[model samples]
Target: MRYHACRIAVSLSLALPLAGCATGVKSQLEVRPWHSINEFRDQRFADVADPWEGFNLGMYRFNYYLDKYLLIPVVNGYEFVTPTFVQHRVSGIFNNLGEVRNLTNSLLQLKGGESATTLGRFLTNTIIGLGGMFDPATRFGLDRHDQDFGKTLGYWGAGSGPYLVLPFFGPSSVRDTGGLAVDTGITYGIYTALDPFADTGHSFAISAGVASLEAVDMRHQQSFRYYESGYPFEYYMVRFLYHEKREIETGKAPTAN
Candidate 1:
């Protein structure tokens, strides 16, 4: 009886771990069967730590459809309505506004020189560039410095919790997503406060429209299309590249592996 019991225990130990695997993240660790269903859904038990792969896949499909039917059409309409010069000016204005977030993040990362430069860019563009409709700062020596709260968090040693496929935003990790929220809120507040509209509601409405236009412009800046990678492991590849980018931004050198 003792010999049979030992054999059975060994079998269960090996088999149990293999019973619950991630849908696509290919985690080496298996979900513990003893845990509740909710635990498995949220717990990180694998290499990629994407416990919500099924939900992510569904969101990805939804985003793709939204992009195909809605976002792209709206962006194209924006392009058609505006002349190239106006579009460039709009892009510049958005870039100029983004400097506030960059400045704050630069200070957080302790890059005093970059923070100074970001402030310079903002002031110069707002004045000479005609409220950021042009980029006179770049014509001189001060180039645009792009920083974000996400990079700040990574610089401080916060691990990217898990890979996520955000609707319309594409690949992002938990840390970066939170960073995006903070940055957006900061910018929205700044714009609303500075908006010429006396009414808070009108200022908010204007800022929200500008923010939507900025999002469309930003999306159009990237040319990559879904499933165009020509490989079966496209999702895995995006997750790897994104993490690598975050690592570089945070001054972490990626291993040769």
Candidate 2:
């Protein structure tokens, strides 16, 4: 009787953790067992359609650690050392530079009004605002129409593919990823064509330095941090919210059913 009881006790202990981990599925098991692995996964993550949950979860943890240990400290130091006015100027410069992307995308989307407004803002800010250190164009009533290639693709009815958690860029879809590459290529080509630093003979160094500053400024402007919501289901929530937000902004329905 003692040996039989020990075996029962061991079996119960082993089953308990698996049962706890199964959560909602265990209750459904009473009705019927899962039909397939896909069915089991679908039920397990019914709240979010995360087919790549394993990889996405890994990237999420990686981003959290990277932000906490490296990016946050660097951004903090930048903010601490730089004056507010200087920071504003830096942001303005980057915003001015981004107008190229905005203008190109606006043209692609056939947004005549937005393209004109973006062009006016770019010219006004670059020439008058001294390379976008100031935003006199906003005061002059030429509002910025921030557009990107991703939105352009969406505008043309391109479906957002699977959810992706990029190494540096974080949450993005397959369509957006491709759009980003195209936009980046366009910008790089334009920069190469203009070659503003050609005369200095240190174009590469100058470009690298500017790129680094732009990266830091970008990080400084963003206020989001990983796990900041204090929710256990933050990953699923973020994934869902990102998809919904993109759908609304792009006016394109998700095609990844």
Off by over 4 Å in 2: 1-49, 253-257
Residue lDDT tens for model 1, 72-181: 88888988988999988888887887788999999999999999999999999999999999898998899877799988998899888888888888777799899989
Q: How many backbone clashes does candidate 2 have?
A: 0
lDDT of 2 by residue, 1-257 (tens): 01123433453355345535666565666645333334444532244446687898799899899889988898899999999999999999998999999999999999999999999999999999999999999999998876788889999988888888887678887888899999999999999999999999999999999998998888788877887654345566567566766666676534656
Q: Looking at model 1, report the run of 10 residues with the lowest lDDT sum.
A: 1-10
- Residue 207 Cα positional deviation in candidate 1, in Å, after optimal superposition: 3.6
Q: Which candidate is the best by TM-score?
A: 2
Candidate 2 Cα deviation (angstroms), residue 204: 1.8
Candidate 1: how large is its RMSD? 13.2
Error of 1 at 77 (Å): 2.0
Segments of candidate 1 deviating more than 4 angstroms: 1-47, 199-201, 255-257
